[model samples]
Target: MSTPVQRLTAEVNGITLSYLSQGEGPLVVFMHGFPDLAISWRHQMKAVSDGGYRAVAPDMRGYGASSAPDDPALYTQFHIAGDIVGLMDHLGEKSAVLVGHDMGANADWAMATFVPERVRGVVVLSIPHKPRGTQPPVASAPPRFYQKLFQAIGVEDDDLHRNVKTFLPAIFDRLSGSSEHGAPPSLMVPEGKHFSDLFEPPSKTPEWLGEAELAEYVATFERTGFRGALNWYRNIDSNWWTAAPWTPGHVTVPAAFMIGTADVAWALFKDNGVIDSQKERVPNLLDMRVLEGVGHWIAQEAPDEVNDLLLNFLAKLEARDS
Candidate 1:
């Protein structure tokens, strides 16, 4: 059956956002991550809406048909969170369960903090609670190679064009950690190699994305441009400063987070203990689980398990509220 898609126009943080929502019941808003659109939640929208909750997903400020502004500062978590609240207001919803993944999860954290009354509950997938008033090293590290490149060369305008022709597959491969299979020349790069190494074609099929999937991503980036998405990364410090007053960060609403044990975030920060620190921030954290075989795209990678987790969490929250 075809899931219904609705378009909404609302002004938030000074930019108009275009969102897609379907089904109807208690409102549930889905916020997507970098390099993604509301369409990314096609499966979750169907599952959640069919389960009796209105499932709403937005293109946010930078992706899909949403307004994309030139100022990087506008993409900070504070602003993005405000956009969500504005969206709820536009929808005539006083409160909604907020669900987010990747960059969207970052915004979800801010939303739950900035407007507690407006968030019935929150679900963080592939991301943990980012405590207010705490600065983690990884988040503070010098910009990643790609980020530095984006800043140094003013690459956004052309990057999207090139990506459709060249870079999207590599990013997906690297993010999924499945770039190599054959000879070193086809995939391997020396230690300390920069993103220049990413230009090479993958030796094997990437486990996370295929040609059709990549084509979709490439087309979206091409149409929407990647700058708006990259702006999220650029506003890290701005987000912190804007959220400075709300310390002792704790979500009074029921909240849960889940990640794949094999996710690259774990591999990258295994020694940093960011996950444990993240858990400490949410006082009402009801559950935290690491799926055995999944990766960063927890929802897409393990939908059935993700759905089960969400359904149970929502049930518990409903019980508590009753």
Candidate 2:
């Protein structure tokens, strides 16, 4: 059964974020991905709260019921990282174990890199560590792409805006490649999908999310709009430049990268290395396990496995603390 979601708001870094929280333990912060809200962590939060820690997940700057600012600059890595820090201060926590999925994982990487002392450890799901450095413009494919088309100022205007209902569903379907009503297929071929497809909704409704879950996301987006969330993609170049000073360095904290074996992202993992270019990126890297039959949404799709791995890892961290 799903844990009952509780709605709450906290001001951090000048932004007000509405989040769904449950459980009790050492403060834990969960960041959700695109088209998701803090409620996404319900399973994990319930699993870990009993360890005397507080399990908290925020809507992020613009994804849920969080305050959405007008300027794109506010959505940069530094600011997003600041939001996490601000959250810590608000909760009176000096440090906490951080976990992120998808874009949230990106922010987790930034947090660990910029403010090591504030983070005890990090567990990344789906997203891997993409170092900030010089790289040629990435090539794109028709169906499978990573270019951020939504970042453009006017892409969502006119026809696309009018047909968002149709667009969203189609985009989600293509991205998932599995009907919302059925089980997702194991393998994802690199058939040319782009970052532009991110903003649109899925052609079919996702089976995993019920009306309550979907309502939370829809309401958040409706209130916050998508600009703040899209700004993360918009500032890819800015983030690289900002990290240029810190780049060429490895993460010193204990870290793990969990990927789904069937996830297309695994294709990017070469030489058994997760991040490209830099060697020994995560100096204290513990493990990188690719779940046998999971997709990009590993946490949601395989909650039991994710929960067990996280518990074991956190237990070790707890042991050292004691």
lDDT for model 1, please.
0.72
lDDT of 2: 0.68
- Candidate 2 local lDDT, 60-162, one digit each (tens): 8866678878777888889889988998888789998898998898888889899999999888887787654455222222332333445565444233444
TM-score of each candidate structure, all chains considered together: 0.85, 0.83
Residues 1-322 of candidate 1: C-alpha lDDT, one tens digit per residue: 5458777777766788888778888899999996677877777888888888888898878787889887887777777878888888878999999999988987778888888899998988877775554673235555553444444324654555555546666555545523352211222334455443555656654655556766777677777767777777677666666676787666677788888765665654445676776656787888888887566667766778888878888888888889
Decoy 1 TM-score against native: 0.85
**For each candidate, what is the lDDT?**
0.72, 0.68
List CA RMSD, all candidates: 3.8, 4.4
Can you list the residue pairs that collide in candidate 1? Answer: none
